[model samples]
Target: MAILVLSVLVLLLSLYFRLKKRQKNDGLNKFPEGPSHPLLGHLPLMTSTTDVIDVSMQLIRNHGKTVKIRIGPKILPMRTSLLTADSHLTEFILSGNKILKKTENYQFLKHWLRKGLLISDGDYWKRHRKILTPAFHLEVLKEFVQVFESVGDVLIEKLRRCEGTPSCDLHPFVTLCTLDVICETAMGTKMNVQSGKNSHYVQSVKKTCRIIIERSMSTLKLTDTTFWLCRDFYTLKNELKVLHDFTHNVINSKKNNKSIDKNTKRLAFLDLLLKFSQDENILSTDEIREEVDTFMFAGHDTTASGICFTLYCLADHPEVQKQALQEQKDLFGDEKNPVITYPDLQNMKYLEQVIKESCRLYPPVPIIGRYTTEDTEFDGCLIPKYTNIMLFIYGLHRDPDYFPEPEKFKPERFDNFDGSLSYTYIPFSAGSRSCIGQKFAMLEMKSIISKIVRHFEIKPTSPRHEVKLSAETVLKSLNGIKVTLKKRP
Candidate 1:
C-alpha cells in the first residue's frame, strides 16, 4: 500500500511538470531570447546567487528586455521569469496594483519570519505597514542620534586598542558596532556583543545568515524536503528560541516596572515594539519576536557591509580619502578633538554622497528573488504562473546606460542629481515590500562614516588589498576587509 501511494504521487507530479512545460512553449517568443535547453529550463548555470546575478546580466546584454528561463525537472524551475529592468516594466511592478501580489515562494521565508512587513502582501501587508510606519517617524529617528553616536564612540575606542597591530579587518568591527547599536536602540536590551569577542548572539546571527544562504542555493526541487530534514534549520530554530527567551524576559521585567532609567531610554526598538504590542490585536508575541529578530539581523548586517565597502573604497583611492578628511575637518575640526552632533551629521552632504556612491558600486543585497503566481504579461511576454524572477540589483547598478562610467567610484555623481528612473537605482529595492529599515540604516551609516573619517587616517594595508567577495547570501568578504587605520593628530 505504501509503495503504491509513493508511485502514484510521483506519477502525478511528473504529469504536472509536463503540463507546465507545455504552457511555457508559447511564452518564449514574446520574452527575451534565452538559452534553448532540451529538458531543463535555462536554469542549468543559475545554481548560485552569483550565477543568478551573472545570468540576469547576460540576458540583459543578449535579449535587451525580458528574459525567460526554464527550470529543469530536477531544479523545479523556480523563478523562471527574469523581469526586464526597464522603466515601464519596473514601474508596473513597483506600483501597488491589485493585479500583482508578492510571489508565493516567499512563503519559505514565512516559515521562519512569520508575517512581518518584508514578506507579507496584500491587505495584511497594508495594515501592518500602517502601524509600523509610524514607529519610524522622523522625530523618532532623530532621537536615535545619541544611540548611534554612543556606538560610534565605542568603535573608535576599540580601533584605538588595535592601533599597534599591523592591520585589522574592518568588516567585523563595523558589524559588531552596528549590532551593538541595533540591539540597544531597537530592543532596549544590552547585548554587549561588541564587548565580548565571542558572544553567542553574534555567532547565532552569523550562523543564521549562513543557513539562509545554503537554503537559497539548495536545488529547488528538493528544498521542501531538505528544509524539513535539515540540521541548519533546526539550529536556526534553536537560536531563535534563545533570542525569544531573552526578549520575553526583558519585556516581562519592564511591563509593570515603571522606573525609567537612562538604560531603558537607550533600548529603542524593544521599548517601541513592547508598547505597541500591548494594543488589542496589534501584533502577536510570535509576530513581535519575528520583527525584532528580522531587525536584529537585517538592520545590522546591511549597514555594516555598506560601511565596510565605503572604508575599502576610501583606502583604494587616497585622493578621495584626502577630500573626505578635509570635509571631516571642516565639519568637526581636527581629528584630535572631533565631535559630530545630529545637526552636523545632517549637514555632511559630501560624506552622504560618498556613502551613496559606495553602496551603488557594491550594494549589500546585490540580488533579490521573487516568484510569480498565475500567468502574467510583462513587457510583451507571457509569464506562466509560479515562475521565479531574479532581480539583478548589482547588474542594474553597473549598467553603463543608467550610470556613466559604472566601474569608477564618484560621489559627485549624486551631488546635483534629481532621482533617476525607478528601475535604474534599486540599492534599497522598490515597491510596497522595499526595505523598511532604510532610514535607520542611513542614520547608522552616516554616524559610522563620520566617526571613522574624523578619527582615523585610512590607508591600504598590503600593496594589493584585493576586494574579493564571498557568496554567502549576503556578499561578505571571506578574507575580511583588512585595512590599516592610523590615528590622526
Candidate 2:
C-alpha cells in the first residue's frame, strides 16, 4: 500500500513537471498574456462571439497589433494561440498551401457543411477546388450577371415599398436578394428570395450560422459530444435537414438534365458538378450537396454583409454616394430599365473603390483562422505546432500604419491602391485560399449599388457615429443599416 502511494505521487509529480517544461519550451511564456482563470484558462475572461471583435480591439490597443490568446483549460495547451495584425506574419501563414487546415472552431460547422470546400483541407480540398475552378470562368461569371441584374431590380422594388416608412433595417432585405442571386447562379434555381420566398431555408441557414458562432465560443460545449447534446445542435441538425433536402432535391432534379452533356455557354456552378457526378467515384450525391451547400452558404452571407455595409457607408457619406452615382450616370445615363452589362460593371471603378473602403472598415469575415501543421516562427516568436493561429484582418485593416486615417470613411484611398501588397488590403483575403467568389461578389455588389443609386437617393437614418458594429454572421451594424429612401427622377 505504501509503495502504491509513492508510485502515484511520483507519476503526478512527473506530469506536473512535464506540462510545465513543455509550456516553457514552447516559448508561450513570451506571449502577451490575456486575462486568465485558474481552470478555465482565458475562456472565462474572453468576451467571445460577435463581441470578440471588441475584445480583440482592446487586446490590440493594449498589446501592440499582435497579441496572444490562451483559451480553454491549461491542461489542454492546444487552445493557446497567437493573434496577429502583422501583415508580414499574416502573409507568411496564409500564403502557404501546406498549412491550410482551418482552426478547430471550423469543426463545429462540419456538422452542417460536411467536408465542403470551405471546411475541407489537403488532397480532398485540392480536388474539389480544381473541379470547381471552371465554374468561376469568365464566361460562366458573365452569364451570372443576368441573375445579378434581375435580382437587383427586385431589391430596388422592395426598397420602393419602404419609401414612405420612417426608416428600416436594410440587412434582411439585402440578405434575401443575395440569397436569390447565389441560389439562382450556383444552384440553377430561381428562389425568388427577394419576393419573400425561401423563408424557411433562409431562416435555417441564418439559425445554423448563429448556432455555429455560439458553439465555437461556448466553453461548456468544447467537444463535439457536448455540442451534440445541446438544444442548439438539435435545432441546427433539423435546419441542416431543411437546407440539405432543398439542395439535394434541386441537385437531383437537374442531375441528369440533357444540358449537362453539352458544352454550353451557360454553365452554372451546379451544371459543372452534375457533368462530373456520373464518373467513377468523382463525386457522390452527398459530395455534390456539400459543394452546393458550401457555395450557397459562403456565396450569399459574405456578399450580403459586404453589400449592406457598402450601402451603409455610402448613405453615411453622401459625397461618396454622389460620386458613385455620377460614375454610374456617366455609363448608363439615366437609362430606362438599365440592365448593367459586364462592361458597365467594370466602368464603375469609383463604386469598386467604395466597396473596398467599406469592406476595409467593416470586413464581412473579420478574422481568418488556421492551424499550424508545423512549428512556425514569426517576428522572432516560435508558434508551436498545432496551435490555433488567428489573423485579425479586422484590426489589420483598421491599423493606421497600413491605412492612414483608418477610422475615416475614405473610398478615395483606393484611387491609388496597389494590388501587389499581398498582406495588406485583403478584404476578400489573399493567398491560395483567398475567397473563390471574390470577382463574382464584386460584380454583384456593383450591380446592386449602381441600380439603387440610379433608381433612388439613399440616406442614412442614423449617422455613422450612432451605428455600432456587431461581428455577427458577418460584420453587422448593431442598430442595423437603417436608411430612408426617395425615388430618383
Off by over 4 Å in 1: 1-29, 36-44, 47-50, 73-79, 99-108, 161-166, 220-222, 260-267, 279-281, 335-339
The parts of candidate 2 lying over 4 Å away from their true place are 1-6, 34-39, 72-78, 259-261, 278-281, 462-465
Looking at model 2, residue 444 earns an lDDT score of 93
Cα error of candidate 2 at position 149, Å: 0.6
Top TM-score hit? 2
Q: What's the TM-score of every candidate structure?
A: 0.87, 0.94
Candidate 1 residue 77 C-alpha distance from true site, Å: 5.7
Model 2 over residues 1-489: C-alpha lDDT tens digits? 999999999999999899878887885567776566766665655565546788888888788777778765666554678788888888887787767999988887787789999989999999988887877877789888889988888888888888866686788899899999999888889989777777898889889888887776676676876777788878987998999899989987886465554477676688778776654458888898899899998999899889888887887898988888888778877783676689988888898999999999989989888898888776687778888878888999998888889999998898887776658878777888888889999999989888888887888774433566766656777667778787888
Model 1, span 234-268: residue lDDT tens: 78788766666766666677666677553443347
Maximum-lDDT candidate:
2
Error of 1 at 243 (Å): 2.4
